[model samples]
Target: MPRARGSGASAAAGGGGAGAGHGGGGRLSGAGPGGQKSARGTALPACLSVSAGCRSSARACREGGGRGLGRAVLPWPPLVASVGAGGGGGTRGWADTESVGKKRCVCLLTGAWLNGVMGRRLGKNKGALNELFSKAAGMLACIIRESAALTRDVLEQHFNDLKGTLKKLLDERLMSLLQEVDAIEQESIKPLDECQKLIEHGVSTADDLLREGESAVHGDVGQQNEKLCIFTKKALHIQLDSLPEVPSLVDVPCLSAQLDDCLLTILKNQIFRHGTVASRPPVQLEEFVEKPGGILVRWCKVDEDFIPQDYRLQYRKGTATHFEDVYIGSETEFVVLHIDPNVDYQFRVCARRDGRQEWSPWSIPQIGSTTLVPHEWTTGLEGYSLSSRRNIALRNDAQSCGVLYSKAPTYFCGQTLTFRIETVGQPDRRDSLGVCVEQQNGCDSLQRDKAVCISTNGAVFVNGKEMTNQLPAVTSGSTVTFDMEVVHLGTSSNEGGNFKLRVTISSNNREVVFDWVLDQCCGSLYFGCSFSYPGWKVLVF
Candidate 1:
């Protein structure tokens, strides 16, 4: 738009003179056009012909610059000439156009689509990974919790099993101890042969002494009576004939009374015999009577033959005090203290009543202990009552006198004999109630061998039979009472062997029913002997 400042041609030709100029055109420094004294070294052109818009000229400049000088006049110079035709000779560079704009549009579109697709895929993968990881975490937690619970259960089961094992071991140890104790007791009671040897030694030297003593006693009595003129003493001697016989004494009204008589005899005999001679004198330790109400012990008389005058009596334990006296008698009797409800006591009493001149021995130690009173006494009955008997009324009705259960009534062919015993009163259901069967094998009493019992709780199989076993439990209902018997399996017996069965149902000692049935199997279909329960009538009430 304006004239170019500091033209290169103008600057190059103005060597020494000022050219045609305005007032301040000549060298202002007053030196020359090329003055080194000017404030600025040179003035630069106001505008540059940068390659912003002129593409053809820029191409020509770039191409011509790569060639040799004078080769093809550059379009740059031609473009300058065209501008100079309008009084301006300069070139300008080209500016960016449509191609770059189209490139930018494509780049923006491709980058946006790629970023969206990749982001979605990455998001989906992350979500799936998180789900799987969460599930695994939950499963791991459940496993850990279950493992803890299982460990707890295992510990509890282990403790219970250990406890059971310990209990079983303890029970076995206790049974072994009991067996050892029984063996020791048996050994203690066995008689020693040494006692016989001791007796033989003493007896060998006593014949002459015993004979002289008997002779002197008879002469003294006969001579003394003549001097005193006490011929009436013969009646005193003969008065002994009036003494009650031994059997009569045993038949005394009560056991307590008989015991008292024996005690009196021991005391009286000790005074008389020990006063006469001392062959190992008798000395009593202590004796007394129980006061108030009690199951007191009393002295009882014994047979003269069984009495040992050298035996002395002593009492141990209880409120009884001490004393010294010889208890001499033909027989020995000593009493125990009385019994009371809920009381348990153990006491000892001894006698040297057998006058082998050795002090009499102590009696068997006895205990007065009562069981737990589970039921209250109703009416006058202090105990329950039970009894079982064959209905004689049925017998009178012209039925069979007795029916045989089998050849071996208590046999072992897996058979059962069920029978009932009737009882009186409502028995104590809470207490242990039942029946027992005892088998006696040739005894003066029916108390020898008792077989198994079928009790209220259930079946007991006792056998000399081949199949020996215990059975299950039995039950009872409320009735005054009834006989419930289950006899299973038969017993084995040799031909002609005697085996008696005694069945006893007891409610304490006061109320009881006892019966016996005798059976013999002699290879016959019919059992040889079958008897009704004995004493059934007395118990049935």
Candidate 2:
């Protein structure tokens, strides 16, 4: 028996070699007399066989002679088979074996070539792949970072907007609350403020009444004291009775709620309601005239049933806060004394009934002022007697024949001097009732050149010269009025302006007028009546 060759079994069998032909396996497997053949009727190729060992140089030579079946097994051309080979077993089998060996070598070379090419391509593309993946990762990281920043900014802006909105709402709410608080404060304090004002007014009025009573008592202890004491007591009693009652805390809410309405109602009641016999004040209190350092005030009651037992007069100087009182019993007119001259005064009056406790409201105020310069008598008139009270002037004797002048010169314009002659006894031509321009020296007389005089016998004289006209005749005990007016032709001055003396004399309803124009020497003048005999009586105003 032939020993089974390891790699050359099929080749040994196909070649019919003398040895066992299975020492080494060949590249292909072939059939033996008792060996199993492959299913395709072809020997297995050595390269495809799993049990085949690596080819050696000596076994290759042996297989190079046999015709193996590698050509049928593989798709490539048989590398070992020559075209010119004989069709004998030896040649054919050798060709088959060589072809199997060549096919195996080609497959190994192809595999190695594919592996080298793939390794070079993979080396070239390695950096590009790594760079693409790195850029994608960096882009993703950048996107994430930007997204986070945008989210943070959005959140911050949203928070800021929310904060501003909240602050504006809070500020508006705070302002509204402050305004409400102010309104509440004013409303709450209004009634208290009015009450405080009333208390202050009452205190001031009491102080004024006390001061007035003290002054009246101290000034005169007789009738003035008695009247002032009674008035003070009555006023105090009225104040006490009319005082507002203090409300308790329990009534605070109701009082505050109705404060204004209650006050208005009370005022209306006081003004319109007749609670007692005395209701309203004396109406139509008027200022009649200005006396010396005082004003005369008068009023009347229009109601027939209203009989006033006493009258209270209150006076105040211009814008003065306090008042001075003058209380009179059963009198409608009273003089507010000890006032300043040339100053304005306001006066109001109230009436008290005989048996009533309440006094009437004060009357409407009347305003008046004292004179700038009061009337007075002239001084040092020689040969004449002057009475300031009666406004009379009389000659000292029948033989008196001089000019009796006023102490102060009259205004050249806008002034009139009237003299009434009660008696012009013993009428003479030299007896005159007129005005004269006298010099400052005592020697200037009515007989001077700048004088105008009218005689009781209806004769007129100018500058000691007889005129052509005759005035109305004056008799004894017949009242005659002489009026003289001086007009300056230019600006008035004692030394420079021209003056005109207009004189009118009337007696028994008959009148006569005389006019004369004089020079600057007649500017400074005196008003008097010249008497040539005794028993001449005249009044000057």
TM-score of each: 0.17, 0.30
Task: Give me the runs in candidate 1 sitting further than 4 Å from their true place.
Answer: 1-122, 193-541
Q: How accurate is candidate 1 locally (lDDT)?
A: 0.26
Worst 10 residues of 1 by lDDT: 100-109
Q: Residue by residue across 353-470, what tens digits does model 1's lDDT show?
A: 4334444423322333222111111111112222121111111222222221211222211111122233222222111222223323222211122332332222222231111232
lDDT against the true structure, per candidate, is 0.26, 0.48
Candidate 2 to truth, TM: 0.30
Q: Residues 203-266, candidate 2: write the lDDT tens digits.
A: 8887877777777777755778677868767676755436655667875543323224686688
- Top candidate (lDDT): 2
User: How does residue 43 of candidate 2 score in lDDT?
Assistant: 31
C-alpha RMSD (angstroms) for model 1: 58.9
